[model samples]
Target: MANIYKILQELPNLSFEEIFLLQEKVTKEADFRSKELLKDVENTILACPQCGSKDFIKWCKYKETQRFKCKDCNSTFLPTTGSSVHWLKKPKLFLRFCVSMFSGNVCSLKTQSKEFGISPSTAFEWRHKALIALGQESPIFQGVTEMDDIWFRYSQKGRKGLKYSRKRGRSSHKGDNDFVSKVLMSKERGGELDISLIKIGRLDKSSIEQRLSGKFADTSVLVSDKHPSILSFAKSENLKHETFKSEQHGKKDIHVQTVNNLAASFKADVNHVLRGVSTKYLQNYANWFGVKEKYKGLKDKVKTIIKDCFSNNKAWDMFMNTELLYKDFILKKSKRTYRCPTVRYRKHQNWNFENAKRGTYI
Candidate 1:
C-alpha cells in the first residue's frame, strides 16, 4: 500500500490539454470495448441468410460494420442483415431499450418513446420485433393439463363507420352485437403453457378436437370446465378427462383453476400493463405474456431475451416481411363471427315463455 501511494504521489499532475487528451483516449477505449461486445453478437451469424451457404468472405466495411459476401450467391450483406434489428436506426440505443424492457417496469410505447427520444411508432415496431422473438411456440403440453378458452370482445377502436356502443362488457348472445373473439389456453402442471388465438368460426366439438389433435399424448389427462364440446372432445380422443363446474368453486383436484388463474392474470396484464391493447395485436400480447411466464424466475432475463432474439430466424423473416401488416391480423376467413345453431335453438325454445308472459298465447 505504501509503495502504491508513493508511485501515485510521484506521478506528475496533468495540464488541462493533457487531461483532455487522456479523456479522449479513455472514451475511445470505451467505444472500442462496446464495439467488441457487438462483434461478439455478430460472430454468431454463420450461414448466408440468402443462399444458406456457409462460405463467407470479408467483402467490405461500412460505417464501422463488417460486410460479408456469399461465395455461392455472390451477394453482399451486413452482419446485421436479415436479423431482428436489421434496419435499426440507432444500434447504440438498443441495449438501453432492452434494459428498459426487462427492467420489470411499465414500458408502454409512449413511455419508451419519451424516455429514449424515439418516435412512438418506432418504439412500437421495435417492441413487437423483440416480442416476436419471445413469441415462439412451446412444446406441447403433457401430464395433467388444464385447458380453457378466454374471450375478448372485438374492438372497433380507431375504425370508421362503426356505430359506437356504450356497452362496456360482454354482450347478450341474441344478436350480432354479441360478437366475441376466443383464445384457447392450456397449461401443463408444473410445465409449459400453450395459448393460441382461435380463428375458428365456432368453438364447437369439431374445432376443439382439431386443435387438440396431436397436441397431447395418449398418456395425458385433461381437466377442463363442463363444456359439452370439451366433454365430447375427451370421449373422441379416448383420453381420461376430468370435468369441473366453474360455478362450484374451491373444489380440490377437479378444477382447471391453474389455467383459469393464468387467463385472469393474462387479462389483467392486457388491461393494466398494455392499457387495453387492440384485438389486432392481442395474440402477440398473449404470446409475450406466455414467454414472460415461461421465463419468470430467470435472473438474467435480458441476456436470455437477447439470445432468443438472435437465435430466432423466423422472427427475423417476419420482421422483414413488410406485407405482413397489423391490419392483416386475422389470417383466415374462419375468424368471422357466425350465429351459433345452439343459441338459435335456445331462443326458439324461449319464444313460448315470452308469448305467455305477454298474454299473447292462444
Candidate 2:
C-alpha cells in the first residue's frame, strides 16, 4: 500500500494517454476497502466556508458529479462552490488537465472534450472558469516595475489582400479590423508581470493616472520610453519618472522591448494553440497566461498553491490581501531603475498627486 502511494506520487507529466493508463492501473489495484481507507484519511475533513461546519459528507449519487453536503448547514455543493469553478460541469480531474494543457498559447477545447469524454459545453465552462481563476491568482507584482503598451490585430494573418493592392471592388479589409491594447507591466528581480486590458486609444496621462490611483499611490519610480503620457503624468503627480530615449540606452535596458517580447510570445501561442479567443474573455485568458508564466516550474507549485487557497477560504479576506499585493508590487514600481541612461526623478519631486508641489514643501 505504501509502495502504491509512492508510485502514484511519481506519476509522470500526464498526457491524455497517460491519464487512461493511470485510471486503469488505479482502478485495477485499488480495492473498495483501500479506496475507502484513503478517502477516510485524506478527504474526510473538508470544511464549509459559509457555516464553518466540519460535519460534511461526500455524496456522489450521480456517479459523474461529486458534491459535499454539510449536515450542520444543510447545504450541498460541488468542489467549485465559492470558487471560480462554481458553475462548472467538468470533473475536477479534467479541470486540472486543462490547466496543464495551458502550457502553450491555445487549447483545443473541442479536442479536449472528445478525448476526455466530456461535453463541449462542459469543456468550455472548464476553460472559462480556469482562465478566470488564473486571473484571480496573479500575485501583485512589486519592486522596480516597468510598463508599456503594444498593439495586436485580431487575426493571425491580416485580411486577405495585398498591402499595395488597388482593387476597385471593396479592396481589402483585414479580418474584422479587430484590435487589442495590451498594457504590459513587469516587476524587476524576477520578471513577474501584471498584464491588463486597455482601451484602443493612446495610453496617455489619464490612463497611467487611473492605473496608478489604485496601485501607485505609494510608488517610488516609473520608467518608460520618451512617451509624453508617462512623463507628464509623473510630473503632474510629482512622482519620479525616467526615460530611455537614446539608441545606446535603449539597447541596454528598455522596458518597451521587454513588454513587446512578452506580448509577442503570448500572441504566437494564442495563434497556434487556442487559435483566436473572443475579445470579451481576452483579459481573463491573458491574466491566466501571466500567472502561469510567473509560477512556471516551481516544484509542486499548483498543489501547494491550491492547498493554501483552501486553508484560508474567505472571499472578503482573499480580496483584501489581493489588493494589498497589487499595491505593493504593481502600483509602486512602474519606472524601474537600472543605470544606462540614468535619471533619478525622486528626491526633488513631491509625492502628493492631488496637492500642489509647494503645499508639501514651502
Candidate 3:
C-alpha cells in the first residue's frame, strides 16, 4: 500500500507527475487522492496580484498565504487570494474538501469535517464559500433560450413555530416561488436544457422583456412547456415561440429529459447532504449544482475537473476571501443556534453562531 504520510508530505511540493506517481506507487491509494494531489499542484500557482508575477519564494510560507512570498514584489499572497478561501482558517483542506464534495466523494458536512480534521462550523463555512464562488463562475447562457418553472416543497416540521406554520412548508421567499414559475427556460435541440431562476415579480412580461432583451437576437426561437405566462411574453416580443405537450416534454430530438434527470439527481443529492436545509437558501444550493453539472464526463475524471475549476486564475482569486462573499446567516429558531446561511433570505429568524459557522456552500 502507498504510505499516505509520505504522499501527504510530498504533496505540498510535488509536481503533478510526481504526485501521480506517488499515488500510483501505493497500489491501494484511492484514485481520488491522485485527483486531490493534482488540485494541490494547480493551487500553488497563485501569481502576485500586485505584479501578476509567478516568481514567488516557495519556501517562505505564511499562515494566511500557503505559498511563499513573491520575490519580485516582496509581497505575500495566498494561493487563492482574491478567491473565496483567502481569509479561510484552513485553506488547504478547504479546497480539498470542496473537490471531494463536488466529486461526490465526501458528500456531507459532517463527513467532510471529520475527514479534513476541521470543526463542523469551519467545514460548513468552507463549503458555503466554495459554493458561492462556484456559482459565480457559471457561464451566462446566451443562445436560443427556453424558460419554465417547477415547485419544490420543503417540510416545516422543525421550523420556527406554529405562528408561521401556514408559510412553513411553502416556499420561504419570493425568488423561490418565482423559481416554480421559471424553472425550465431553455430546452434546446439535441437534449440540452439551460435552466435559470428569476426573482419574484420578475416573472411578468416586463421582467421577461428586461431579462431577455439582447440575450437573443430579434429572430431567435424560444421554446417552453406551454405556460400561458411564457407564451404571452413570446407573442409580445414577436419571437418564435413553440410549446410542447407535457407528454412531449422530452420526446426524442425535442426532449429536455436528460437535463431534467440531471437536475433531479442534483436536487436529491443536495437535499440528502444538507438534510433539511431551510427553503430560503434552496436556490443558492441549486445554483451550486448547476455550476458543477456543467463540466460532466471528462475523460480523466476528477483530476480534470479540479484543474478546470482552478484554471480561471482571476475568478479564483476574487472568490478566495470568505468574508467578502457571503454576509447572511441562517438560524434554527427553536435551538437558538445559528444555521449556515442559505443563498436565500428569511426575516425574523434566529441563529446560533457556532452552528451557523459550519455550513457547506459548494
Candidate 4:
C-alpha cells in the first residue's frame, strides 16, 4: 500500500495523455488479478452438493477442473456445479465479473461487459444465473416484521411473436387482470429482509403462505396494511398481527417504511435502470435486489457472496426452468413443475459402463 501511495505521488506531474495511459495500464493489471484469484478457489466441500452425502470420492479431472462422484446418487459433479459460476467457458474472468456485479453500484450490461471484455449477452446471462441462487439466501423473518406487497406489470420483454402489446410498469386497469407480478417484502427490525416473488397476480392467502409459511417465528408479529390476504394468512398461521390505515401510513414508528423504501428502490433499478425486464425473469431480479440489500453495511462480503452463489445444486437448470416457474406461478400448475431437464436427462442416462466396455452393450 505504501509503495502504491508513493507511486501515486508522481501522478500530479503527469499530463492528460499520460494519466489516461496509466489508467488503462492499471485497469489491465487489476483485471489480471482475477486469474490469480482462481488459485484460492479450492473445493472445500466434503459432502456431495447434489445429495448432501459425505460418502463421495474424487472421480477424475475434466478440462483441468476436478470432478467428484457420489456413491449414493451415483452422479458426477464439479465444485462449481449448480452455481452461478458453473459451466463458465472463461472462468478466469469470473472473480472480476463478480466484483463488478456486486460492487454496490450496479452497472449496465454494456458497462460490465466492456469492462470484462465479454459481450453484453454473456453479462446478462451471468447476472441472472447469479441472481437465481442468490435469491435463495433470504433472511429469516421474525419479531416486529414489516410487510408489504409490490406489483409489476406483466411483460414479455424479449419474447418473440407476441400477440399483444408489451406490458410495462403496473397495470393501469383498475382490477386484477391476473397479469401483475407480486413481490412480497418482509423486513425485520434490524434490517435482515426477505424479498420474494410470491405469485403472479392478486396477492392472496394461499400464495403468501406458500412462500412464507414457517418462515416467521412463533412469536413474530406481522404488521402490514389492511390487506385481506395478509390478514387471512396471519389468522391461519395463528400469528399476532397489526394493521395500518392509509391515513396512518407513515405517521408512527410502526410504519412499513422499510419495505416501502425497498420496493421503491428495487422498482427504480428494474423499471428504470435496466429499462425494464421480462416478467419471466422478474424473480431473478428480486433475488438480485435482496442480495445487494443484504450485503449493505457489511465490512467483508466477497467470500460470503461467492459461497451463497454456489450453495445450491442444479441452479443452472432452475434458471433455465424459469419458464416453468412462470407457467406454474402465473398460469396453470403443472404436474412436472419440479422435474427439470437435468433431472430427466439423468434418469435416462446409463450408469453401468462396465457392460459397454465388455461388449455387452454398444
In order, what lDDT does every prediction score? Answer: 0.65, 0.50, 0.50, 0.69
Q: Predicted candidate 3: what Cα RMSD to the true structure?
A: 10.1
Shift of residue 27 alpha carbon in model 4, Å: 11
Q: In terms of TM-score, how similar is model 4 to the real structure?
A: 0.78
Expressed as tens digits, the lDDT of each residue in 1-362 for candidate 3 is 16858757767897878877766767455545644554574465756654667787665555433455778988766555545544455655655676677777326667877888888867766665555444332223434555555445533323343454444333556553322423334444333344443333234555455445445455456766666767787887677766788877766444445556665675576456555454444544665566555555654555554444444334433233222222331121111233333332324222323322222221
Query: Where in model 1 is the C-alpha error above 4 Å?
Result: 1-48, 51-80, 158-178, 204-212, 232-238, 247-250, 320-362
For TM-score, candidate 1 versus 4, the one ahead is 4
- Model 2 residue 335 CA deviation in Å: 30
Instruction: Report the error of model 1 at residue 219, Å.
Output: 3.9
Write the residue-wise lDDT of candidate 1 on 1-362 in tens digits: 47968756744776778777877987897578657655866677777766669998988798888888999999887766655566566766875676677656445788899989999977877776676555554467679998888877665443333444435555556432335666788899898788866543346676565456667887788988887778888888787898866677557777888888989988887776766765556666776777677777787665666656654444555543322333233444245432211111222121222211121100
Q: After TM-score superposition, what is the CA distance of residue 13 in candidate 3 from its true location, in Å?
A: 28
Task: Report how far off residue 101 is in candidate 1 (Å).
Answer: 1.5
lDDT of 2 at 284: 53
Cα lDDT tens digits, model 4, 1-362, are 37879888998999999999999998898666543343334345667655669999989887666778999999898777655576677765766677667765656789888888888878877787776766653456768899999887766676665556666555677676566667788998775788777666678798777667787887677889999999999899888898888888777676888888889999899888888887667777777787777887675566567666765454565665555445554444212122222212333232222321221100
Order the candidate numbers by TM-score, best to worst: 4, 1, 3, 2
* Model 2 / residue 174 / CA error / Å: 10
TM-score of each: 0.69, 0.56, 0.56, 0.78
Candidate 3, 273: how far from true, in Å? 5.1
**Candidate 1 has which clashing residue pairs, if any?**
none
Model 1 Cα displacement at 343 (Å)?
A: 38
